[model samples]
Target: MKRISLFLLLSLLLGATVLYSQNPETNLRVVSVSPNAASLGTFGMIPTSNYVGQASLSIPVYEIDLDGKKFPITLSYHTDGTRVAQEATWVGLGWTLQAGGCVISVFGSNAKIYSANYYDIKGRVVKTVRSNLLGGYDITSTTYTF
Candidate 1:
């Protein structure tokens, strides 16, 4: 009886651990800059995007720069597409800034997105690590990225 109880407890603990780690509310932010130092080149503008995933759902938001204005985009979840959200809701009004690169946000964590990236101005991946997240739990992450 003692051995059986111990085995059952270990099995339950392992299952719980697997579920928590497998389906975590992970968020990823990407930032890249141009090699040129003159101006915001055609593809030099460092766009911002995020993927808030909880359980099996996801909510992705991307901001594309045009001329001197920033466009707000909110794409919904999709299962067929490779990049998740295909249909989106465009709201041309939102807060955006381009200090060193085009800034974009989804929740309220600007520093999280900015600091999560490991790439520098040369577009090369550097060291990357973070202690904790800068946003809340997203319960609507229908789609996710690997």
Candidate 2:
């Protein structure tokens, strides 16, 4: 009787562990790509000291499909001279940032997008590229000098 009870208990614990490991909500899906700096070059304006070199860019909102339902993903960009940061959040899942550029975060069971920064001749960022949810790229342009 003791052997049978122990076997049953061990079996139950193993089964539960397997089920927990297979849960979809805990899995992380990340999507990232290389930056295409050649395609996005400077826009003809040279940098000057008199002009304030602070600018912001806009990243489009995206929707993610999870278990036959759609959830919205939003981005927030903080622009400050050379410290331009972006934060992406999804329906209360989580948020992440990396080195004042584009980053990826956990979004339940859906995919996460990463971002990269492009700089100008003065070593200031002029453009940024982030992967969209639909296998494409989203670009944001910023003018560092006025």
Candidate 3:
């Protein structure tokens, strides 16, 4: 009986190891957002646009895979009545994975501003940065924490 139990345990352990080895250690998530209200603004300017009123805006949400590269692959989805924008003038454009975290970007068409969110390994947002058309104004590099 003891020998039979040991053999069964070893077989189970080996089978589990084989199953685990077949999958890669990677986590991929797609994020989307849209603005609830927006205002007119200029390029290279800080976002200070006032919301005219509460209204539904049709915006595109994209799923992007950066793979730690400079450029990203973004897939867009058009849907109505999804109000999930970070700011009044910000619309989500794309996303990427960098430095053991996820970075989600938003674009302000009138303002020509780009904003990004940095998320940790646990998928919690650690920091956010906003920049202008020239990739300036408030963009900064940060280190990811576990």
What's the lDDT for residue 23 in model 3?
30
Candidate 1 lDDT, 12-113, residue by residue in tens: 998886463343434444333322211222123333234532122224466778898976554222222223422222321122222334432223223333
- Runs of candidate 2 exceeding 4 Å displacement: 21-146
Clashes of each: 5, 0, 1
On TM-score, the candidate that comes out on top is: 1
Task: List the candidate numbers ranked by TM-score, top first.
Answer: 1, 2, 3
Q: After superposition, how far is residue 39 of candidate 1 from its true place, in Å?
A: 7.5
Give all TM-scores, in the order shown: 0.19, 0.18, 0.18
93-135 per-residue lDDT for model 3 (tens digits)? 3221122223334332223223554444333454444212222
Model 2 RMSD to the real structure? 22.1
In model 2, pairs of residues that clash are none
Candidate 1 stretches greater than 4 Å from native? 30-146
Model 3 clash pairs?
34-85
54-78 in candidate 2: lDDT tens per residue?
A: 3433344776687998765444232
